[model samples]
Target chain A: MSLTKEQCFDQLLRSHDVKPEGKSAGWLEQIRVEALASAGALNFPSAKQDDWRFTDLSSLFQHAFYPVDSIASVKLADIEKFLIPDAIRLVFIDGCYAAGLSDLKRAGSGVTVTSLAERLGDLRVEENFGRHAPYKQDAFVALNTNFFEDGAWVHVSGEIAAPIHILHVATCRDAPSAIYPRCLVVIEPFSRATVVEDYAGLNDGIYFSNAVTEVVMKDHAQLQHVRVQREEKNAFHVGHGSVKLGTGSVYAATSLAFGARVSRHTLHVIQNGEGAEMHLDGLALIAGRQIADTHTLIDHAAPRGRSVQLHKCIADGAAHAIFSGKIIVHVGAVGTDSVQSSRNLLLSDKAHIDTQPQLEIFNDDVSCKHGAAIGQIDLDALFFLKSRGLTEERARNLLTHAFAAEIIAKIPVLSLVESLGRTILDRISGVRT
Target chain B: MINKESRILLEVKNLKAEVAGVEILKGVDLTIRAGEVHAIMGINGSGKSTFSKVLAGHPDYTVTGGSATFEGRDLFALAAEERARAGLFLAFQYPVEIPGVSNSALLRLAYNTLQLDRGLEELDPLEFDDLVQEKIKVVEMNPSFLGRSVNEGFSGGEKKRNEILQMAVLEPKLAILDETDSGLDIDALRIVAKGVNSLLSSDNAVVMVTHYQRLLNYIVPDYVHVMDGGRIVRTGGKELALELEARGYDWLRAAA
Candidate 1:
């Protein structure tokens, strides 16, 4: 009672000299520390946290020091090596501005791409800064929105054509452990752009990537956001990306994750305005003891909006895959059309997939459907393919790769798609060609 | 190549099979030698398809009793794929559509499996493409067929030809064409029949099962067996097929 409202944050970090600054980010960061510290026993997975029961995350917190260091030592040429040839590359290291390596064009008088430090005072940033994130509810999200060191904000001015590809690479090669690369993309009215963001690894050292991407689609602006996360199997990754759709605007997001030891992505897309649309599709190829989780939410706040969520999982060896998707068609969201599908194919008898596809609709004049299926390779199809003279193992690999290829090809980035397709084919089929 | 002393390449002895607890192929016996095309003609529900499925090792049916020997090896000891690699191919009456598996890829896998069994070096994609392009002409299939998924959304005539394309790829010692001409128009049937006829060799054999005799006009058979009540009721030369078409299956069923 003797201190200001930021008093809670001061106590948690009292042991260190990293005091809060006066910038907009510093203010938000302080709020996150306070909120997380005061989340008030809301919930913690049991030592066997039912949902987190399978994942024992005690090792993630065991590492104490994490410093931001993907600086000048991490050269632009080095980042170029991972550009996935032919892809529109945009690179970010250690969440800061590396201007020599970014290719971004200003849009229609209203759009701009600038460092978060420069846009700290921009009016739009002030308005949409942390709008969708529930700082007081979720602990980790509040923490991310609080301590994000440096990121970019992309703003589209008007009716534009062409896609935007943003590549985020965490290149911290020493000094400490973690790197958080964040981005914010804002589309103005009637503009359209496609952005493919890549998350890659350059070192064999263990690290953590806690990224947050916020996308705002204004009236009539169409945006396609494609993200690929290919971090190391030794890394720990947690990312939250949220989008708010305006009236008549369209948003499509496709994400592919080749499993890390623990990679979890929590995504939400809200159709806040009428006549808006959103599509979310993700595919994960998991092997060894790696774990991948995709949790998504589609909120139809206005009437007559459209939404779709499709997630596919292929688990080999002793890997695990999880998908939890929820769709909410509010009472005011009449005439909404939504669909959710989760399809999983397990290669080993010990491989596991936990999927729950659910829907909560309050509007009567709406169409909502959900489906989920987890099964082994169809023995009949396998036998049929094998009876043509292919070995049993070869037939199984071919059918599995075919199933995953259906979704990966839709990514549309070309080289990366094929490279990842080949990797997945080799891992699943255990064949070189 | 199959190392069997017997002149008959395929010999069935009192083959007993069942589906869902009901017996379909009951105590049936037959034999076919190399360089012979034998046809099994039967009415609906007379168990003509069951014999081919039992030979193909379709898991749905249980072979309760009896045995089938193909190329001197016990066909019952092998699963469906092993039997195919050992040179036994069954041209499905209705080939299944694999939504995302390309026809070219499937053919390459099939062809390599056979080559491996014969102790020949396997062909990769590029080499397999050169080999497959030639085989496609046998079925008169379009070059574009190599790019599309196997049997997915294909028309009736196209599916039957695709089955023959698989037979061409595997080059089985004993080719069992089960109702291979059922859904084809007259023109498609002739093309498929031509493809099947070209594959006939002195060291290999073909077994054609069909209800209609129109297909015989394109590729003549060496022998024809009229089946009724789960057994061969009549056996004769190629003339029997023409005689059955002239007289109809009712006469053969009554003769049983």
Candidate 2:
């Protein structure tokens, strides 16, 4: 029998086997139950909604998704190509922690990195878990909050030299299923670290991955975060990331979306104390029948807050890319300075992009500016390269790569930057003339 | 410097072209030979730049009539890159800025492409770096300029120097400098002229399209042609440039 939307959601909710085991597990269990109740009350965002106006979720609801029942056996060699050198690796297979493939030996001093399942009862995990991401109205976040089996929990109390890499590998083999992967990163006062959250698919399978990540930065803490989503070509991914900054803290984030048939990511960052700085950079390079949507909101609630954002999208074939950025300087946010820019490149006649940058300032002593530009390959630049003995195709690809390098160069990780550059070059090499 | 036995590098015959359906080059004819440097000087509205662009096969200009041949081969039969591979180059007055593409990368690619055309092995990055380091000395450029984006945020003189740098690497047989000396100061102009003069040999030729004779003062031309109303009204020895510089282009326009 064909299932309805509510029936599918109910089955997904019932598939999770929640069992409170140890000290403070009851508190965690209570939070999960309340999230479950919220998930039951909320509905999936549809095309008629304001926030989801450009992204259509009707196709995501067509497939009946159940929770992963067993952990697929993944070998280290199977994931060897995805490993980053000199990084503390945490591997998860189908939303379940895979200890055999992870490297936790190099996690330097004053840092705690483990599976969320292991630290559920700890005071540090309990204090920030389910605290930052708003799940009351968002169905995806609520679903993740209620059903996530395990996740990566990183706590930094002092400086960490080695970067933390959370690798989430999806292998949906048995049936059409859903995986909820969550992460909570807490950087204590006066500490600094770098984190890389990466998601990849093992095969071309139809599945769903709903992810939620919450980051908390105390006073004077600095962090560099990079999120890369490279799912299979026939998968669906919805991710929500929330960040809260304290006084004198600095946060820089670069999000790269390159895969999946349909994907959307929402990032919300708020400066809750004075003199906090934030830099957000995003790039979506997709071709074929892909849709990548990004929505961001930066809220400056305190005085002397500063933020800068640059989002770029390069679409080829029949792909569609959407970017919506909103910056708000609340009342009494004096000396707030913000800049936002959106640049899009359409490589084919059928490719399309929609970019909207909005700013709301409530104070007189603030400087805010935003601009968006959508264009094709610069003909003059192409001619310049061609006049130097490069073929038209090579010139076009070179110009396209140059367009994307502006954002990829901002990534703090050298290895990631090199790999992303190679990927973009390879992707654009096959661009249809 | 003319040699009677010199092979013809480029020959133009009453070439006519237009942009946006407006005629810019009306019955323009010029001939360049190996071991020679020719300069075409004219007033602001004369078709000096248009004639050079038309010869380089710019897409915006339509070749309505006449013909151009390079080394006895039809120049119009090849694409822009093909013409470049055939040892033809144009030094743009305003070089376009290409952000995110490193200067070394573009130069190396252009160099390797020519190497392959000549049936030679391509150089690796290390080897290419060594070669480019040697070539940058021709333009007196800093080594750091090779690592920056192509022409992005470069000073006007620096952009011109970069053009000469490319010319040095490619070693084209026929190079048409279209107002390359317009934005250059005296010092930069001397440096650029020195680079071009060093590259000239008995086997290749140069065509300089300019409005002033200041550049010719350094890279002394073998012949100077006065263009007026989209045509070369007068051709003379190098002394013609001196006469036009002393007496403005009005006398040439009136004579035409």
Candidate 3:
């Protein structure tokens, strides 16, 4: 007999039912119970859905993943390579906080960088948790809201010079496990900070990471965020990001996706107050039967809002990359200026890309422009480089590197930029097409 | 500087080429010696640019039948970049812009590749910067141009000047300038011409393919060949350019 949608979700939640749970705050427990009911009510999105048309989740659903109940051994040396120097770190393993591996003492006054399990009673967490990220329509967000136990909680009231690194490492396990990595960042009025949310895996083992990040920017707050996901090659990654901008606030984000068998990131940004600005840049470099999908929505709800977005995908070796961007201007949001461009590079004959940019403007005084381009390397440009004595291979490599460097140059971190540049160069050197 | 003992730099005999199965160059012949400059004047669709592209091995044009010898070697045997490393340069009529690649990076890479081919030491960034700083003066370019993307957002005159700047850096043995002065103003034309003249030496030669005699006035050619109907109909001294400018290509077209 074919199992119903609720029955399938029961298999996913069966393990959580057997585990002993700690007593949470009254409001937080109410949220988890409501979210569990929502998860059971929401059907799993299939290829029939518009957003899941290009991305298939059948492979991910074949395994009934159990939430990790036990702490897996992870050493500091294992995660040292992913650490950024002089930055405050809060590390998590298998969705559980690792206190020994994390450094939290360096955070200054009026700043709190700790785990959500510890800050359950904090007013900031109580106010913003499960509020910014919507779970009614998104099944993955509902699943995360139901199962997530611990995550990074950062609140900045004053200027913080050092970037905060929220590192999540998924350890290899024999049983198919599900890991929920959550992050909540709140920047108070006129405060500024930078944060890096990095997700990586320990070994090439099968696991599932359902992550959610919610960012709240107050009036005149400025934040620079960089999200990097390089999961194990055999893992499934689904991430959701929801951001709300206040009056005169600015949010600049750079998202990079490099690894995972099949991964999808859905980011939604809303400019709720006047004169807010948003910059969203993304790059997805995938190959070898991999699929990377990015769906973004930017809403200008107030007057005089501005946004600029550039998203690029490089697909090779039968890989598929998808980008769908939508911009909305509310009826009263006049004087909104937005530009979005989606560029793709297919390095092999079998590689594929699907890009769409849509703009919905309700006001006549707004300015919006968007374009999408997908093709191989320009032959004339290749010949020009060759005529300058560059070998054909070197010429192709240089052109591909330059195509990716346009977005990579905007990243605020210096060491990450250099390392990512090297990664791109190394990948392009082996590309034959 | 033309002398009888100067080595033959390029020899094209009865060359034929076509693009997309349509013949554009039918049995064209030309010859150039070291320390010599030759200008080929033609009207539109006269196969002058085709000859330059065919020699550069552009993928679009296929050689139906041709024989080209550069420095006593079969030029067709080498790839486009191999031909470049062997000292054959083709300055495009319309220089292509490469976005996101800096100007100095391309110049340095091209210079180092040729240096490696010639068994010379390659210069690092500092040394290459010193060399490029000296070469930028040839076209009177601002040092800031090296930091921008190659040829991106450059004016017509600046593009032409950049082509000559590349020519100066490569110092090719046989440099073919294809309509290098087409969109240049009088001032840019003089600067480009002067840059080319400064690169000329006893061991190198140049072939300028143009429609007007304006560029020839700045750096006079040793010989001028008037081409019509895909073949050279007349050859003369530098005065032939003046004659073509004065009488136009109608006379050559009628004869061919």
Candidate 4:
């Protein structure tokens, strides 16, 4: 019989020889051991589970992928194209920090940006790392905690003049490998920052990129986080992110997923203090036989907290997209206002979309609303555009681009918005009619 | 007026069409010539709207047995966009609303496309803005409407007026106004009728489909056809519209 996922993971972990050392090694070792034990006890969710009903991860475990212990040889020049100009950049390749490609000098006094592996001795790292995103129940998160070699750690004390860009490039050589990328961002009280987590792959190979990000926002802190995933079509990507908001803190996040054969993103947010606000926006575009799934949860634990979310998916060819968003308002979270909307556009008869937007409120004074819709292109609108002398192809492309622009426009970075807009347009135009 | 010497802009012979396998237009035959305004007056379900839709190559309607030629070219052989590029414009009865696309963009695109089709110079956005400003006066439209989305949240009068503005911009060889007067107030009707009058020329033709003779009051028709039971039973001069209005379509149906 084939080995279970836990057995495979245990075997893979035993084969790696690197061990934590130095002054901060004790806590790191404890975290690693606890994560491994939790991962070993929990089973991988199958298709029979309600949350995994629409997604099948059987094919993902079929291949034997070991931890990438050392940095793979990747040229900085090759990854220069993925860098955002005029921004503080942290570049990581194969789950290891690439100092030659990063702009470490640009990080001034108000901002602190470094690899988490290098800052293991920092007291703040011990306080915030793995605190927001618990991995006891999630196999993917637990695996990332046990195997993450290096990732970006950003701490903002005051205000960051420019956005910080973290670029994760995956390059596989010789064997099908797996890399765990971790990110921890902490915004101190009365501070503000914008962070972009961008993932891109170089070559076409079988690789697994399991990533986790934890964000902690103090009182009155403002943070805008954007995650962009554009991996190779042959890669597998599973990412988890968690955010905790303090009193009067504001957190806004936008996630865009465009590539990978099978990808999933799970995001969780909690308003821990009164009057904290959260805004979440996401978009996924997939074609061919690709599958893209997104699951999000927002919990309002304090009074007068507000949250708004909008998620959209565009599926063409035989691709499938799944979205599940839930908002929970606890009994004491009075006057909480939460809204969630999910929209999907199917471009072909074979394309499929499953969306569920749910709201669970235990407070009588809370206002919560949720909406979900799945539809094809509007025929009336199509005919209207065609009758205006545009070719049917151009008309369809224009409408499809407009549908995606609703989310792309919400991004604060102008250059990133323009680049993502062009990418989405090109993909929509390339979809076969 | 229309005469035997005038150039024939559109010729329809035994045109039979249906929508969703239900026959709507049964053997409709009408000929329109240049420098003339023809009005097809009929009650509801008299196949007047179907004839216009079929002529414009709407995909929902299938031409089972018919022949429609526009300036010696087979109209049924082209797609909806091709028919539009060929200078056949249809002012829909109920104009569709596209939420995100701006009105100015749609207008300029249609204008530039027709210009390219006719080997004319295309205007840039600034130049097109000036031209659109000049044409909007025909319907007394506010310049702000051009900046908004195409017909999105527009009132009935505004949508009809927008349709006429499009016709003015495209400058088609043959324009079909399908029930363009149905949902308009008296003021909007007069404005729309006057816009159609100003755009008329000896090189092009207009076919106005209506159920009332009020629209023909401001823009008189050269030829009027009374339709009933999916066929035109009577054809006469502009006076036929007045007679149908005064004595209703039942008289014509009984006579046929």
Candidate 5:
């Protein structure tokens, strides 16, 4: 018999014991209980649901994934290729902090970087742990909240000289397992920093990674957050990220999705103060039977705020890509300016893309625009390239790489751009690098 | 300046082609030889562009009948890039705009591929940069254009100049310029024509597909063929362009 959703939920609940520690144990235990209750009340999203219509999760629910409590065997040398030499690294193996593999001393003064499991007693952790990501609405968020063991915690008071790299490495043993990776970032006023969250797996297996990340940008703070998901081909990954911007704060985010059998990302941003600026960009390059979905929401509550979003998808083989973006301007939010565009390139006839761009405005003074385009590589462009001595396949690959470079160029970190470019090219060319 | 001693470069006999199951090139017979320039002129819908595309092996056009040979080798047997590597170049009427690909990179790739085909030394980036800079002077192009994407957001005249720049870099044995003077001011047309004239040599041949006789005034074609209903109806010397300009293509169509 197939495992029922309720049975799966019960199994998850019984798999791990709650071992709360430090001064914030009571608060943490209360949060976990409330999240579990929420999870119990809400069922897994069905295909009938409008938000889950295109992406079916029946296959994901059939897998009996246990919570990985013990540390799985992983070599630091194997993950050394993904490390940035100039940045501080925080390594997580199967949702638990790997202190032996991390470089904690690289953080300079005015910055605090540590694992959330170790700093449970910190007051800041209690204040901002579940503030942005509401668990009641999303079952995945609730599951992550109820089951997350440890994640990276970063606090920046002033401009940090180097970026912070958080690596989530998933390794499976004999049985299929699940990992809930959580991250919390708080940037104080008048500071600037860049954080990169990279998720990768060592082997191919049927696993689940439910992740939640929350970021808080104080007044006049500037932050660039980058998330890269390159998991095993048979794994399932669902992530939710929320960001809150203060007065005059600047927040920019870019997410690159390249792996997994089925991957979905939800990003929410709220401009809480006046004159805040937000920029969101994403790219998904998937082939084979994989599916990648990206959903984003930006709320402009303050006046004179500006936001720009550009999302692109390149799907080949029988792959599918979905992008839905919503921008809301409150009644009092006048003089708001926003632009959203989603462009997709389908390399094969079997590939598919669905794009929905929405804008809700209560004020007439706002300037908002949205557009979506789905097309194959232009035949004329391909012919033009071929006439210049390039093979048809090489020309198509070049155009596909160019389509993705538009979003990859928006990355703020200069060093990351080249490597990301190479990775995207390799993905398009079917190279194993 | 036709020399009998020169070798035949391309020979097309009774070529017929169609696009979307509609016949466009009924029968286009033409002969091009080294050390000569041929201009194919006709009214709109006269299959001028289709004939050029057919010779370059465009996927949209299917050659229904007849054959074309270049240097005694079957031209129809080769793919588009293979045709290009075999020293056949076509300057498009409407150059495609490919965003995010630098013009210099495209040019260098074409140059290196042709160099490899010809067993010549391929230039590296540093060497190719100097060579491209020297070639840009052929069309009086700005050096900054090399940094921009291939024809993305380029002006009409700039796109034409870039095409000539490619031709200059590749140095093809046979080049067909389709309506190169379509959307150009007099100064831009003169610059483009001058670039083509400078690239011409006794070992190479040029075929100009044009609507106006103004371009012929600069390049000075050795043979001008007027095409109508997909066939070359009239063949004459350079003065035929002057007469055709004086009395438009309607006169030739009516005479044919």
Candidate 6:
């Protein structure tokens, strides 16, 4: 028999994952072992737990547990069905990066896109791998570290103009599959690149894609990271996209969610250095009983950093949307300018959206503001448009499109935005018609 | 005075109206002959606006009793949009705004709705644009206005002028201006009043609803009716408006 639950728990005690930080390299095994123990604790969130209030967590306990495995059968042609060319594409199978199929040469010498296993084989890790993002007491980040054996290792040199795209294809056929797809991207001083975390599922079976993307950009480096989730509705997805920006570094991220029955995408960004800028734009079009939660945190550790966040949600049927964004400014982080807004549109009366935008500023000389609005379509706008020669159904479709366009127009890719726009129009056409 | 051979444009008998379960117009009566310009001046909350809304069949104002005859048809029986298509129009005091609905699209709808109502061929976009240019010029409105969303960001003056433009396009037999002069400046008032005058014909009638005596000087109603406490208390010509202006609505109410 493989390792039992108690043995796994005992092994976690011996691992470095359980040990606290700065305790030396001997703590690595302890931290990893403690991560396994934390998973077993299964901390049940109650009314006191504010994050999972809208999402049902009781059902998670009933699911049959299985170890995270890696399968090799999934082909490239099957993955190619979801690929959008011109989008810097990096394909990974199971937990390992497939260099034979991936196109990373145009990325140039200024960029380093390699597999985590290869980097480990070559002993190329100069600094700590999972040091900045510790996984001690936190169960989820710990889980990420426990399964970090086969992740994508990436680096963008300073002053580089090109962007990088990383695609994570989570597949489960016959056996219960689970993989922790981690992204470790380091941007040197004054470098610029766009990193994408595109997650797509292959089959109709129940799978789990628990991912973590950790980024650290040096001074004057700019990075744009997009996390797109298009898994099956039966899939379970819980992810974290974390970042630490140095002085004069610009960071922008977008989380597009249209899959998974229960999916939560977490973002934690820190303005560690001054003169930095950050923007987080998220969009989710949820249907059926799908649940999508996007929780973001922006910490202004230094002074003179600017940030703007705008997230829009369109929920239909009984689908639920949850958005909680927090911006925290440290006491010395003076001249910190930040603004965040969340707007949600519920198409059906049964559909629900819980949006929260909070700002906690300790700096005296800083500008910080946040707002959230949850409302249905204006009925008057519908009748007015219908009276103008358009049919009643067509009129409502136009108004809903206009409401969503306020954010979709901000996307740099026109064709993708347009196709997404049309898809949204078609989805709501039933209500108007 | 109205022309005898032209048709009885509007006939209402015992028109009752209530708002939010509170009866406003107990039982009102009014009639407008073809080509006649009728003025309705009232004290605050005398149910003047309610009367116009009742005639337009606004869903909020329930018609508890009585009937309105328009061109020999039962006007109280139709829906709001149908009433508008059946040659009936109410220029609201506070016109509602639609952010993304274009003004040109709204005008086309009104034009086509009336065409369907009158059993005429519908005008296509090309033909409609051609027809609207003449009406736009007649109202002295800028061509750029057509590109804007319907009343989305219109100024006070532009909204009233837009109301008259709708009236000009619909060409209703009996047009009710529900306190349209409340927000307009002198220039906007003159332009709107001129547009109304141009639309006036032997086949159409105009009912000017106002609280001030100033608008009467420009519109020049042939007859003026004083309304107080939910009823018309006094009836006279242009002198009544001038007299009310000089001595307030109390003097007319006390005299009648």
Q: Pick the candidate with the highest DockQ.
A: 2
Order the candidates by DockQ, highest first: 2, 5, 3, 1, 4, 6
**Could you tell which candidate, 2 or 6, scores higher by TM-score?**
2
DockQ of 3: 0.77
Q: Write the per-residue lDDT of candidate 6 for residues B1-256, one digit (tens) a residue.
A: 5666767878888777799999888777787898889999998798888888788766578888887898888987765666666677888787767654578877886688679768999899889999888888667899788878777788988988888888887788789999999988998888888889888888889999899988888888888988776667777889989988988887766776
What is the DockQ (computed on Cα atoms) for candidate 5?
0.79
Residue-level lDDT of model 1, residues B83-166, one tens digit each, is: 888888888888888878899988887787778788999999999999899999999999898889998989989999999988
| CA lDDT, candidate 3, residue A47 | 84
Where does model 3 exceed 4 Å of error? Answer: A1-11, A18-23, A104-106, A431-433
Write model 2 residue lDDT over A1-433, tens digit each, in one string.
4566676677667776542232338777788788888888886766778788988665666677877777798999888767888888999998989999999898877899889999887898989998999987788899898888899999999998788999999997757779988899999999999999998888888789999999999999999999998888878899999999999999999999988889999999999989999999999999998999999999999999999999999999999999999999999999999999999999999998999899999989999999999999998888778888999999999999999999999888888889878878988997221
Q: Tell me what fraction of the real C-alpha contacts between chains A and B each candidate also makes.
A: 0.67, 0.80, 0.73, 0.53, 0.71, 0.12
What is the TM-score, restricted to chain A, for candidate 3?
A: 0.95
TM-score of each: 0.84, 0.96, 0.95, 0.92, 0.96, 0.75
- TM for candidate 3 is 0.95
lDDT of 6 by residue, A128-234 (tens): 46666646544567776765546667787854444466778766656545556878888889887877677877776766677877788889988877677877767
Tens digits of lDDT, candidate 1, A1-433 = 2333233223322312462242565555555566456443332223354445445454455443355533645676777645655333456765666677776553335557666666877788767766766555654455556566667777777644444556666654553356657778888888877777667666655667777788889888898788888776677777788899999999988888884577888788889889999888899888888888888888999999998878999898888888888898898999999988999999898889989887998869999989999988887787687678667787888888888887787775677677777877777866422
TM-score of each model's B chain?
A: 0.95, 0.98, 0.98, 0.97, 0.98, 0.96
Give lDDT per model, in order: 0.77, 0.90, 0.90, 0.87, 0.90, 0.75
Model 1 segments beyond 4 Å from truth?
Answer: A1-81, A94-118, A158-165, A170-176, A203-205, A430-433, B1-29, B43-47, B59-79, B112-137, B140-144, B185-187, B201-203, B211-214, B226-234, B241-256
The alpha-carbon deviation from the true structure for residue A107 of candidate 6, after best TM-score superposition, in angstroms, is: 5.2
The local lDDT score (0 to 100) that residue A290 gets in candidate 3 is: 89
lDDT tens readout by residue for model 4, B7-78: 988999988899999988878889988898999989899989888888887779999997999998998988
| Better by DockQ, candidate 4 or 2 | 2
Error of 5 at B56 (Å): 1.4
- List-wise, what DockQ does each model earn? 0.60, 0.81, 0.77, 0.58, 0.79, 0.16
